[model samples]
Target: MKILAPVSSLSEALPLIESGARELYCGLSPAAWGKEHGDNIWLNRRGPGKANLADLEELEDIVTLAHRKETRVFLTMNQPGYVKAFYPDLVSFVRDTLSIGVDALIMADPGLIKRVKEKEPAAVIHVSSLAAVLNSSSIAFFRSLGAQRIIFPRYLDLRVLRKMIEASEGDLEFEAFVLNDGCVFEEGFCHVSHAFGGAFCHNPAWSYKLREISSGGNKVSQVPAGGESFQQNVDEYKRWLWLGIKNFGGFPGPGGYPLGMCGLCALPELQALGIVSLKIVGREASLRKKAAGVKLVRKTLDLLEAGCSESELRERAGELKGVPGLCRSGYMCYYR
Candidate 1:
């Protein structure tokens, strides 16, 4: 299994590369968050603490660094519809990034996928997990458009995932989220955008809303829907969830809302089954933590490859625990 870590900063890049991360994924700037950041960088105004033109240059530096180590850099264009609708300028952003020649672009929107392919046919496109690709039809649609990989929706259990893999028949590479949080919504079915006037920023559908509510010294926003907040611009919402926000962790899976990080130590057993990538979440994670995560996954893969006893692997997995988020169990479908 190959390990892909999320890189929020150039600082996070090197250590993850050294620790055996085969790929890294992240947004270009605050616009990537859409309306969540609320600073209008997507509207072309300056966003506070946002990645700038300089940041893209720095990303080139990171890409150069990763290339030296033979690692891939996956840029996220995964915000459900938040970035594209709100930041139309993003068309150029996509063009520019592909021009820079990073490994692949992870995308969720079909229109965006069309646009990206139209402009940069040479750019590798990976279906973002936000696309909620639960069926083979969805898989075939992306394959027709030349998607190189699809990040399997986390809501899929091992059985459904296995079937999807079989159905793809090796036409598309499959990537799975092995660590960090996941949502309950069918990847593309989230309604937060429509509900919030694109202000709340979850899915690009324009069905979500954000009410400004006060919480302690700072104001906090909530996604009554799912996945919008986490996928949008800004960084690391998990810290707040870990601090006891019930909305993120109260659910058991990705049905109503999102749940927290999934621990997939059990996933290594699937390697022979043909999953291409084992992905970690949150590009915003600190350098040390991301690097540590990379090392942990690499070790896990090595042990699994050696045919190390499952008992031994289980012992190692005991060190890492899974957390629950707001996704209530039993609700299997996104809209129902």
Candidate 2:
């Protein structure tokens, strides 16, 4: 399987490629974007900040360098949806990037995809995970729109993933998350703005309460919530959320690797299932973290190629992360 690493700048291109990334994806927001739409509106889902490259020249440089190493570069325009007024400029921006030798456009908005295809029919498009493509019908819909690949969302069950891949019948390429980052809610359904500060789900100040429901189920009563068993379930859910948030503070686990959701152990099955690319998320993360992620996935893929058993691969992956306990607990598993 091809290792697809996230690139945030020209500087990160060579290091990531040298570390075994055969494919690179990044976001771009040109200077004119802020001037035209201001800071409130984001050019992509990541919002206007370090998550995206600030200029096109830098992207061009990164693309040029990546192509030299036989590595493909994909640009993200994967905001779930965008305002109608941004279409004219958005189309132009996409065309410019394609002209700069970007291998494909990673996009989520159907209207944007249609517009891009209309302007540049031969342009390669990878349907973004934010599109929430969970079923075969969604796959067919995107394929009809000239999408060459689909990046599966993080929450899909393994059975569903297998069915979807089989349903494709080798007509389209597939990419799945392999490391870093996780969302509490389905990303496509989340419309909250991050410009205010952080995402609504990631806010640490928020609190949760369990209320007793009336027998008729028409009202919530001001009671002590539930018995010990029910409260234990609630506590466990909270613990899951905390771990999902990387200990609720973005702290790294052992070896300074940013600890979040991971799918290293699923590599063998994904490769056998015809997955074309294994994506390493977190374009906005530190350079160290990004490099470490690529290296970890690279080592895992190498082990797979060496004919390691699934059980051995799982143990090695946990050892590589230095958190076998977390792996055993299923807290960091992407498939689980």
Q: State which candidate has the highest TM-score.
A: 2
Give a tens-digit lDDT track for model 1, residues 1-336: 688888766777778888888887766664344555554433221222322223577678778888888888888777555555544466677767766768898888787788778777888999988787888888999888879998877656667777777787456788887665444245467654322221133322333344768878687766546564634423333333332222233332222212345434565545756887888765543565566666666766776777777667655543332222221231211111
Give lDDT tens digits, candidate 2, residues 1-336. Answer: 999999888899999999899999999888798888887777778777788998999999999999999999999988889887799999899889988999999999999899889989989999999999989999999998999999999978888999998887447999999998777788888887766656665543445676667777677665445656655666666666677654436677777666778999998888888899999988888888888889889889999999999999999988888888888888777897
Error of 1 at 241 (Å): 7.9
Off by over 4 Å in 1: 30-54, 82-88, 184-187, 191-260, 320-336
Off by over 4 Å in 2: 203-207, 215-228
In model 2, what lDDT does residue 102 have? 95
Taken over the whole model, the C-alpha lDDT of each candidate is: 0.62, 0.86
TM-score of each: 0.68, 0.93
RMSD of 1: 11.3
Worst 10 residues of 1 by lDDT: 327-336
